[model samples]
Target: AHVITHYHRTIDKVTERFLGKRQIGTTGRGIGPTYADKINRVGIRIQDIFDENILRQKVEAALDQKNHLLVKVFNRRAIDADEVVESLLSFADRLRPMVADTGLEIHRALERGETVLFEAGQATMLDVDHGTYPFVTSSSATAGGAATGSGIGPGKLERIIGIVKAYTTRVGAGPFPTELFDESGEFLRANGFEFGTTTGRPRRCGWYDAPIARYTARVNGVTDFVLTKLDVLTGLSTIPVCVAYEVDGVRVDEVPVNQSDFHHAKPVYEEFPGWTEDITGARTFEDLPKNARDYVLAVEAMSGARISAIGVGPGRDAIVVRHDLLGAS
Candidate 1:
C-alpha cells in the first residue's frame, strides 16, 4: 500500500477563514497553495528536487515573489530562500533513499501477481473540482486522484473502496447541508468522538446522508462502502438518517450545486431505533447485537452501496471485515 498525503493550506489563510468565514483551524501545512501552485505549474514536484541547481532556482523564484507579497501586501515577515532551499533539500535527501518509479514498481508487482493497495487520505465531497467549491481542498481528493498521484493508468484499476463515517462529517469550510449545531449534533460528536485525525479539529458532524453517499459512490465508482464509526450509535434509543433534502417547497434527492441552496436545504430524516450497550468488541457479524446488525443493513439500504467493513473504534483491530474489498484475503 502506498500512503501519500497532500500538502495542507497556508497558515495565514486558514486562520483568516478564507472561504467559509468560519475558523477552519486548518493544520496550516500550506496544502492549499501548494496544490494550487502545482495546478498552476509553478509548484515544485518531488522529482524536481533531485537537481540541486533546479531546486535552488525554483525556491529562489518562489521565495523572492512570496516574500515581496508578504512584506508589501500582507505585512508579514519575509521568508529566506536559502532556508527554504535547505529544508527542501533535507526532505529530498530522505525521499531520495525511498523514492522509486511507482509506474515501473506497480507494473512489476502486478506482473508477478502480487497484491497492491492504494490508500487515499481525503473524501470525494472534499475534492477541489468535484466537491463543494471555494470551501473545497487543494488536490483531487477523490478516487480519480489515486491514478494521477500514483502514476498509474485507468484500466488497471479493479476497484475503489470508499470509506465513510456511519454518519457524516466535514472538517474545513464548505456548505454542509446536514450539519447540526444543536444538541443532537453534540450527541453524535460526543458519542462518535468525531475529531480529525490529521488536524485534530472537531469535525462537523451530522447523520448519514444517503444522497450524498450515493453521489460520492457514483462519482468515484466506489465498489463498496466501509461504514466507520457505527458503534457510536449503539446506545441511542432513536437514530436518525438523512435520506433526502427538502428546499423551499421542493423535495430534493441530490445535493444542490449552489451554496445558498445547500445551506437552505433541510434534511428529511428517516428515524430508526437505536440500541443500548456496546458492540465494539464483537468480531463476527453473527456475534453482533441484533440492533447493530439491523443498523448496518439499514445503512446499506439507504447508502446505495454494500457495507463491506464496519469500524467500531479507533484501534486497528476494532474493524470488522465482512467482505474482501480488494479481492484479496
Candidate 2:
C-alpha cells in the first residue's frame, strides 16, 4: 500500500475562485491549490480522512478564509464546510486500505537493494523555480523536485532521462522564442497531434530548440534524451533547429537569466536536410535514412545529453532504441 498525495476538492474550489479571470491554463482539478496548501502547512492529508473530527476541523478552518475570498472577492458562492467534510469522510474507508508511508516504503525497498523508478509528471520548462516566472506550474517539475516530492535524496537517483520532442510545442501563456505562426506550425500541430491530454488545448508548435534542450540537460543532470515525433518532420525539404537566441542585440547561446530577456528573445536557427522515407517501421538505428540519422546525430551533438532512444511514430512499438538506458551491458 502506497499513499500518493492527491488534490482535494476544497483546494480546487479555492484555486478556481482565486484565479477567476487570470487562470494559468490549469486543468481546474485543484492540483495547484493542493500543492499550495501543502506548502502553506494547512493541507489535509489522506490519513486525515480517517479521523472525522480532525478532518472537519481542518475543512472548517480552510473554508473560513476561502469563503471570505469567494464571497467578497470573486462574488462566487462560498463552499459549505459540512459538505466538504462529508465528501472527504465518504472516501476514507476506501482510501485507508491504500494509504501507507510511501516515503518510508521506498526507503526500505532501497535498503534491500531494490531499484525504484520515479516518473515525474511535467517537463523542465514547466518547473516553477527554474522556468519562466508567473507562467510556470506551481510545483517543482525539475530533477530536484523528484527528491522533495518523493521524500528521497537527490544522490539516490541516477540516470535522469529527458523526453524531448523533435520539434517544440507548449500550451497556455508563455514566452516561446521560436513559435511558428505559419503553415509549418499548422503542419507540425496536425502531424504530431499536438493537443493537451487533460485540457484539450491545441499546443503552440515551433522548430526544435537545441539551447533549451541543452539548458534542461544541464539543470536536470540529464544523462540521456528520448527524442519523439521525428516522423512528423519527414517529407519537408528543410527543418530548422534553434541553435541560439538573439536577445535584443546580443546572440545568447544559452537560456537567458532573466524572464524579460527570454520574452523578447528571437531564435537563431540552423537548417538541416529533411528525409522523405517513412521511419515508423524502422526498429534499428541504422535502419533510418542517411539524412534522418544525420539529423539525430547533429541534434545529439548540439544537445548536452546522448540520445539513447528515438520515437519515429506514435505507436507503442515505434521507438528505436540506440543504447541501453540502464547501462546493464
Candidate 3:
C-alpha cells in the first residue's frame, strides 16, 4: 500500500556540464546528479530534511564540489548553500507524512499473502548497466534494478511485465536499427502522438524492432508484455518489422555485444499486411482484423514473451486482456 521514493533531488544541478558538446541529452532534471550523490555517499535522504543542521551540512558539502564545477568548468553561476538548504527544508512538513520504510512494508505485505507490484521508470534499453551505455539513464532500468532500487528481494518478484508500444520510439540519442526517415515514421509519430510525457520533446519514431523486444525480454526475464498503441498502426498499407539486425556484413539475431557494432547495425525487415479499419472500439482480441491478429501473434512469437494484453486505443477500457497479470487463475 506504500511507495518507495529513492534518492533525493534537493539540488537541481547535473553532470550535463561535464558532457560539454557530447551531451547524452538528459532531461536536465538533476536525476543523474541525485543518483550520483547516492553512490558517492554524500546524498541527503528524506530523513535528513527533518534535521535542520544535518540538511544544511550535507547540502553545503555537496555544493562545495558542485559549485566549483559550475563556476570554473561550466562557467555557470555558483549555487548558494543556504538557498539549497532552505528550499529543501520548505518541503519537510509536507513530505514527512508520506515518508515511510516502503521496503519493509512491502516485504511484510507479501509475507501476509498480499500482492506487491514493483513499477519502474524508463525502459531496459535506457538502463545504465545493461543498456546502450553512454546514451542510457543514470540508474539501473531493467528488472534487476527493481531489487536494488527498492529494498525488496529479487526472489519475491515472480513476474516481470514489459509494456511496449506497437511501434518504436526514442526520445534521445542512441543506436536505433529501425528508424524511418520517410513518411511512415511521420505517420506513426503524428498518430501515436509520440512525445516525451514530461519534457514534451518529440520522439524519434520507427518500425517495431522484434530483435530489441526479444533482447529486453531475455535480459529482464519478462513473463508477459502489455502491447500498446496498436490502433495507431491503422490505415497503413503495410507494416515493416525489424526481425533482425545486419552488423558488419553478418546477420546479428541478438543485440550486438559492443556499442560500436550496435551503432552500425542495419535492420532486416519482415513486412506484414496492414489494416485500414478503425479498431479503437474493439473490446476483444478476436474483434481485431485478421491481419492485425496475425501481426500480434508474429510479434509475440519473436518477442519471447506472451502478449497478455493489447492496447487498441487511448481509453482505460481499450485493453484486450488475454490473461490475468497477477497470476490468479
> Mind giving the per-residue lDDT tens digits that candidate 1 earns over 1-329?
21112212333463355435465444566766676566656677787667779877876776666667667765667777676666666767678877877789998998898877888787787787888776676678888887887777866778788898888898877777779899878988988777788878888998888889888888888888898888877777888888889999799988887768887899998888888767788777877878788888987887767889989877888888889886842
Per-residue lDDT tens digits for candidate 2, residues 1-329, read 11112224444555655766765666666677676777777778777889989888887887778778667876668787787778778888887778777899999999998878888788888898988777777778988887988898998887898999999999877789999999999999999999998788999999999999999999999998999999999999999999999998899999998999999999999999999999999999999999999999999999999999999998999999999887752
**lDDT for model 2, on a 0 to 1 scale?**
0.85
- lDDT of all the models against the reference? 0.76, 0.85, 0.85
Worst 10 residues of 3 by lDDT: 1-10
Error of 3 at 63 (Å): 1.6
Tell me each candidate's TM-score: 0.89, 0.93, 0.94
Clashes of each: 7, 0, 0
**Cα lDDT tens digits for candidate 3, 213-326:** 998999999999999999999998899999999988999998898999999999999999999998999888899999999999999999989999999999999989888898
Cα error, candidate 3, residue 309 (Å): 0.7
Which candidate wins on TM-score?
Answer: 3
- Give the Cα error of residue 297 in candidate 1, in Å: 1.7
Candidate 1 has what TM-score? Answer: 0.89
Give the clashing residue pairs of candidate 3, or none.
Answer: none
Locate the minimum summed-lDDT window of 10 residues in model 2: 1-10
Pairs of residues at least 3 apart in sequence or in different chains that clash in candidate 2: none
